[model samples]
Each structure stands twice: as structure tokens, then as C-alpha cells.
Target chain A: MALTDADLVARVLLDDDHHAFAELVRNHQSSVRGVLRQLTRTDVALADDLAQETFLRAYKNIRSFRGEARFSTWLYRIAYNAFRENARKRKELVGIDEEQLQAEQDTRTVDPALRHDLMHALSLLPLHERSAVLLCCQNGLSHDEAARVLDIPLGTVKTNVLRGREKLKRTLAAWGPN
Target chain B: MNEMTEEDVLDRQLLEAAPYIDDNGFAARVVSRLPAVQRQRRSMRGIILVGITALGSAIAYTLSGGGRFVNEGIVRLSNFPIWLLFVFAFGSGLVVGACAVIVAIRKTPEVRNLRRLQS
Candidate 1:
């Protein structure tokens, strides 16, 4: 049987086991990176860097993992903070370059026009709304879990998702359902 | 079309179409960047054990009349040249001054900022 997250955590805490930690990195890397890639507007390189920082921070603070929440949820919280901090720094610098954002969206979308429309609609949403929708809808987190990850109230998470969905629907109505 | 149902359909479609990137050694990359695991702090049990042993030793020494020996040794040392006392004081001051300088250098904002940028 595969080791539970708690089991791996115990190994890391008690024995300072790198191998166990490596297993954890392998297990959760995809979701963490996926969330970041979306959060960073498909800036894969920056997302990967933030993901690395998240894991490193998690390792440094592993002893503080008191099993209060699911390990993945805790990890998501760290990833969110890393993304927010990097976003703040980037905002302080030159702000996000429009061309760069378009280029990133271009690479990820399969149907250029439709994907571009959807991406544009998503980009129009406020950051918190975008994050709440992504976490709850795309990332398959419940509203409660999304709230925990975003460090916002449960009602706010629901409101963001509702408002975000409504906005996307209105924006995409011209395209209609394929 | 009912507004609520139309919006729900769009939400479902968007969720199902969410992009997922392949890992492709991402985990290995993160593991490579992790700093070495720091040494865990000493446990409370170990600290308590050491404290108990130290207290027990001190109590045993006191009960065994070891204080007389310490007093006699101090008396003999006191009889030595007064200049020797000054030398000892100066040496102690030098050691403390060096330690303070080292700590100050480590605590400087530049050093801390450099470390932060590196990490």
C-alpha cells in the first residue's frame, strides 16, 4: 500500500528522511504546478520557480504541520502565498507586459480564437475571483477548500465563483455553445 | 434560455476544458532546489535529562563537602600576583569584544539582504 501523507510526514519529522520528502514532492508536484501555471497566466517558468519555492518552504516548516488540514490543502496554501508574493513583486517592477501575457495565452490554447476569448474573459475577472474560480472549478476544490487555500471566507469564495461564472458566460455568449 | 441554466452549462464546459500540464521531471527539479534539511532542535526530554543530571551532580558535591576544596583553591589563587588578575580581565574583555564584533557583522542589514536575495 502507498504510504499516507501523514506517514510520510512522520518520517520526515522523526528521521529527517529526504527520500520520504521526495516522494511527497513527486506525489503533489503536478497539482501544485498546475495551479500555479494557471495562476501565473500560463507563465510556466515563473510557475515552476514558485512551485520550487513552495516545496522548499514546506520542507523548512514541516515540523509545524499539525495535521489540522489535509496535507495537499496546506501545500496549496503555500503555493498561493508564493504566487501572491511573486505577483506583488512583478507588479512593483514593470507590471505585467500585455504582449507577454498574450503570447503565454497563445501557447496554451488549442483553438486560438475560442481559447483566446475564454482566456480574455478570465483575465478580465478580478484576481481574487479568478483564483477562487480556478481553485474551485478547474482545480476541483470544494468552495470550502478553495476558501481555505485562498484564506478568504467561505461565502466570499462562493460569491467569487458565482460572479466569475456569470461574467464568463456573458463574455462568451457571442461564441455560443459549440 | 434561462440565465441560470445557461451560466451553469458554461461553467461546466470551462471546468472540463481546464488545461493540465504534464509534470516532466518537475518534482526532481523542485527537489534539486531544496536546501539541505536543517537540524531539528534538541528535544525537551534530552534537555530535561541533562538538567536532572547536572542538578544531581551539584547536590552530591555539596553533600560530600566539595565546597571546602573549591574555597581552598580560590584562596591559593588569590595569593598570586595582583597583576595576573588584570591580565585575566584584559584577556576576557578581548574575547568578548571579538564576539560582539562578529555578531554585529552577521546582523548587518546588507548581510541579511544579501542572504534573502540568494534564497
Candidate 2:
């Protein structure tokens, strides 16, 4: 049986167990990377770099995690902050260059059509809505948790998710079932 | 089958479109690149512990009239006979050396236990 995150965290805290931390990294890397990839507007290389930084920061500050949130939620908070900090350093979002994003996406051959539609629609979303949607829909974070991760109010999270979903529905309407 | 809400369907679609990235040695890369954070934390804890201990010792020493005791001992030592003073100095040296050795041995078990647990 897999160990609970608390169990693994206890091992790390009490014994400084690298193996336990590695287990955590492996478990959460996908979602953390995914959220970052979308946030970076499909900048795979930059997203991966930020994901690495997120894990590094997480390791360094693991003691400060108060456990009121789920482990993944805590990781998401770190990942989100890392992305925002990098974006600020790079001087704001500056909007997406969709053509470049498309070129990058083309290099991967997995479910191209659906992934393409999803990425494009996500790009069209307003920043707040996109973050809310990604955290709630794609990353499986609750609205309350998403609010915590994005540092937005819970009401704002709910509003963004509703608006984001409505926009996504219209943008991808051709692909939706009747 | 037809009862799914539009929001539910869209959420399902988004979830499906999101891919799970394979590790492909990502974990190893992260583990390799991690700083010596645990070691840094341990050393920091040790520093704080030492600082607190030194402060406590200073306060206790002052409260116990340690300086006066040392001064009185020195004055008394000067008054002792030469042979008795030599014996007193030798015994004091042995006692201090034994206390140092005992403190060193007491720290060894903590390290041994850590190694045993990790193994």
C-alpha cells in the first residue's frame, strides 16, 4: 500500500529521508507541471524549469507546511507562486504568442486535436478565469483550495470557474455533444 | 448516460485533454539538484541549541556566584602548602578531563542511533 502524504512527511521531518521526498516529487510532478505548462502558455521548457524550482522550494520549506491543506494543494500553492514570481521578473504576462505555442505543442504527438482545442480555448480565457479553471477543472482542486492556491477570494474562484467554463463551452462548442 | 450537465461534460473534457507527463527520470533530476537543505537545517538547529545553551550557562554561572567562587579558590590555593597544592592541581586536572570524556561519550549514542535508524 502507498504511504499517506502525512506519513511520508513525518519521515522527512523526523529523519530527513530523501527517499520519502523523492516519492512525493514523483507523485505530484505531473499535475504541478501541467498547471505550470498552461500558465506559461504551453512554454514547455520554461514550465519544466519552474516546476523544478517549485519542487526545490517545496523541499526547502517543507517544515512550514501546516497541513491544514492537502499536500497537493500545498504543492500547487508553491507552483503557482513560482510561476507568478517568474512572470513578474520577466515583466508581466505580455499576452500569449499562440503561433509559438502551437509550434511547441506540435512536437508532442499525443491526442493532438483535443489537446489543441483545449490549449487554444484556455489561451482565450482571461487570466483569472484560466487559473481558476485549470486549478479546478484540470488539476482537480476544490474552489476553496484553488482560492488558496491563487490567493484569490473563494467567491472569485467560483465566479471565474463559472465564467471560464462558459467561455470554454462556446469556444469548443463544435466539439461538444448536443 | 444523457444526464450529465454541460459543466460536468466540459470539466470531463478538460480532464481528458490534460495529459499525465511521465517521469522519464524527472524525479532523479530533482533529487540530484536538491540543495543540502536537510543538512543546512540540522546545522541551523545545532547553532541555535548551542546559542541557547551558552546563554543559559552564562546566566546560571552568574547566578551561582561562579566568579566569586573562582576568585576565592585562587586566593585559597595561594595559601596552601606546596605539596598539597600540587596534589590539588593534579586531582582537579583528572576530574576535568574525565568530565570532558563523559560529555564526548554522551554525544556518540545520538549519532549511532541515527545511523541505525537510517540503515
Candidate 3:
């Protein structure tokens, strides 16, 4: 029988079994990667580092997961926290140098040659709005699920989704208004 | 211009263009790293255990008779010599530390693929 996430978590917690911990990583890696890629503007290096950090953090804190929700939900929460912490650290490291940071952001702003201008526009959004769109629209997560993953209220999620859509519309409209 | 919103475009484009982002070998790599993490943890535990045992032995020897405990029907290690306790502690610490370092070296990600696999 396939081991449920709860069972794997239980095994790891009880015996510190890395195999069980690995199972958890295997289960949610791709979806985690997908959301992370969108959030970090396909900065694969940063996403990979954060993914590893996320799993490590989860391994350390598995005992605190009370199993009140699905394992993916709990894992998503960890990923979100990892992204938040990394972003905060990045802001601190960059100091008040908006020019350098904006240049970096511009570089990450999707290749113009790629025909997927919509996706490129989505990547340009503020982190919260982009995250809300990815989680709710692309990932098919409900408002409540997105809110839980983002540690925000459902109403905030709704507003972000609305604003994110509006911003993307404006961005794409400037691109020949297709 | 008609009312073709970006959301409408993205909704359709994502359905068609969001190539299933499955990073091949991700699980395998993660699982492969597990044994090393486990070994590191186990060796650290072993090192701690050995250190504690050696310390207890030395403390007990210092607090009581400084004699060597032999296996001649002895039930307690309290009679072990202070010199033996020192030797055992130092030797055990060396062995445990060596094992821990070896495990850590072996576990280092020499061939790890850490790039975000977003294909």
C-alpha cells in the first residue's frame, strides 16, 4: 500500500527515518516547484535553494504538523513561509538600492522572445498578487486554500486575485493590446 | 477593440501552455540524499552517546576508588581505573568523531542536481 503523508510523517517523527521524510519530498515536489517557479520568476537557482530549505525546515518541524489538513496544505504553508523569509532577507541584503534591484527584477522579467507574453506579465506582478493568481487560477486552489497557503484572509486573497487580474490585463494590453 | 481580457487570455493560455512541470529524478535525488542525512544524524547521536558514557565513567572514577574493573564476575563499571577511563574517553571520542566526519564527507552532495527543475 502507498504510504500516506501522515503515515510517512509519523514514521519520520517517531524514528527519524530519512526514508519517510524523503517520501514526503517526493510526493509534493513538482507542485511545489510549479508554484515556486511562478513566484520567483523562474529563477531556478533561488527556487531550488528555497525548495531544499523548505524540505529541511519541514523535516525539522514535522512534529508540529497536527494533521488537521492535508499534507499538501501543510507543505504549501511551509513553502510560503520559506519564500517570505527569503524575500525578507533579500530585501534586507539589497538595502535601499532600488536601481540595482529593479535591474535584477527586469532581468527576471521573462524573455521577450517567448511568445507567452501573458505569463511574462504575470511574472511581473507583486509577489502577493502573482501568488494569488497562481494558487487560485492556475493551480485550481480555492480562495480559502490560497489564503491558508498565503497566511492571509480569504477576503485579502479575493482582492489580490482581482487586482492581479487587472494588472495582468493592463500589462498585456500594452503589448499590442491583444 | 473587443473585450478580450488578459485573464481570459491567461486562462486559456495556461491550460494549453502550462507544460506539466515534473522535474525528472527529483524524488530519486531527494531519496538518495536521505541515507546520508540519516547517517549524519546517527553518527552525531553515537558521538553524543559515547561522549556522555566516557564522561560518566570518568566522573564515577574520580568520585570513588580509582581501580580498574575487570570482568571477573563484576556487575558494575564503577571500579574501573581512572587511567583506563581517560584512555577510553579519549579513544571513544576520537573514534566517534572520525566516524562522524567520514559520514559527513561521504554525504556531501558531490553530484547533487540542485537547479530548480522547471521543465
Q: What would the per-residue lDDT of candidate 1 be over residues A79-175, giving only the tens digit for each residue? A: 9999988888778324345465455445543344665567656765567777887777766788998899899999999998998887677656634
Q: lDDT (CA) for every model shown?
A: 0.76, 0.82, 0.70
lDDT of each residue in B67-102, candidate 1, tens digit only? 777788789889989999889889999999999999
Scanning candidate 1 chain B in windows of ten residues, the lowest lDDT window is B110-119
Taking chain B only, the TM-score of every model is 0.36, 0.40, 0.31
Point out the higher-scoring one by TM-score: 2 or 3: 2
Docking class of 3: incorrect
Q: Score chain A of model 3 by TM-score against the reference chain A.
A: 0.77
Per-candidate interface DockQ score: 0.16, 0.25, 0.12
* Model 1 steric clash pairs: none
Candidate 2 clash pair list: none
Q: Candidate 2 regions off by >4 Å?
A: A94-112, A174-178, B1-4, B37-119
Query: Candidate 3 deviates by what RMSD?
Result: 12.8
Q: What is the TM-score of each candidate against the true structure?
A: 0.63, 0.68, 0.58
Tell me the number of clashing residue pairs for each predicted model.
Answer: 0, 0, 1
Task: Give the TM-score comparing model 2 with the true structure, all chains together.
Answer: 0.68
- The prediction achieving the highest DockQ against the true structure is 2
True contacts kept of each: 0.38, 0.54, 0.28
